[model samples]
Target: MERPSSNGDCYLSLHNFKQGGLVYRDYLFTKDSLMVFNSFGDGPISQSTGAREYYFFPRKNVIPQFSWNSSDRRLEVTATDGNVVFFDYETTAMTAASNLLAK
Candidate 1:
């Protein structure tokens, strides 16, 4: 998700993966670096839901270099750990009603 903010535009990405169980990673992309928060099961399972309690890890800053394509349709991100990720993206047009509401 992308949204306008007072400082600048903010981007958020959430990813889920399976280790022994389900784990969630939340990333907040900022101007200088990307902040990451991780959450996973830790405690004992619940009697009703049969799910373990969730433990959220502290946020960490991961520096990444961002490059946008000339057409603005593709984005290339290089992380400090020498990992590269490419994303294909597009913009959404706001409806007239939404634009008015935003104003």
Candidate 2:
């Protein structure tokens, strides 16, 4: 996951591999919160389904204070519920170049 600057938007992509298939979800960060946009998989997933569900029942409020450790390739996000979620990511050349341009 690439860290977003304050007031910047970030895309979060989650992938679950099981039963020889892949389940994926795409979310966007806006106003310090996450909103689900697209998803595909099987079974009853617990995540928010679509725009309506996300608008009505959003995910946890994420604080704007994002921490990114380039060396470790980790990102830390704090939520309003006093919980923290950490993500480890791999950066490609395109992503790294894009991040530089963003800065």
Candidate 3:
């Protein structure tokens, strides 16, 4: 939550909070995957399958939450019953990918 960089840009960091917990995140730019670990011990992490198309897919107990595209900052995911959801970092939020998918 705190931006340690003086440039004031959107960046990521892992630091310890006063409450005695670790917040960590790994941005795998190569795989276009992200692993976020919060204090609650439940993580929505990204795992690499090394597939050329989707590259990687996130799964928790056989449910894929998100997919990654390294070429473009896009995340192709599926919701309940294979409902497709996409997220593009080029803009912001899921709406960005929705726009691209809509087009």
TM-score to true structure, per model: 0.32, 0.34, 0.28
What is candidate 2's lDDT per residue for 15-70, written digit by digit as tens?
32321343344444343444544444555555524442122123445433356768
Residue 72's lDDT within candidate 2 is 64
Off by over 4 Å in 2: 1-23, 28-38, 41-62, 91-103
Alpha carbon RMSD to native, model 1: 15.4
Ten-residue region with minimum lDDT total, candidate 2: 94-103
Superposed on all Cα atoms, the candidates' RMSDs to the truth, in angstroms, are 15.4, 11.8, 14.6
Candidate number with greatest TM-score: 2
Clash-forming residue pairs, model 3: none
Candidate 1 TM-score, true structure as reference = 0.32
Would you list the rank order by TM-score, best first? 2, 1, 3
Model 1: ten consecutive residues of lowest lDDT: 94-103
Model 2: number of backbone collisions: 0
Q: For model 2, how big is the CA root-mean-square deviation?
A: 11.8
Per-residue lDDT of candidate 3, residues 3-24 (tens digit)? 3246533332222233333333
Per model, how many backbone clashes are there?
A: 0, 0, 0
Tens digits of per-residue lDDT for model 1 on 1-103? Answer: 4454576655434233332453444455443444555455555434212322221223223444556666856555543433444555332111111111111
Better of 2 and 3 by lDDT: 2
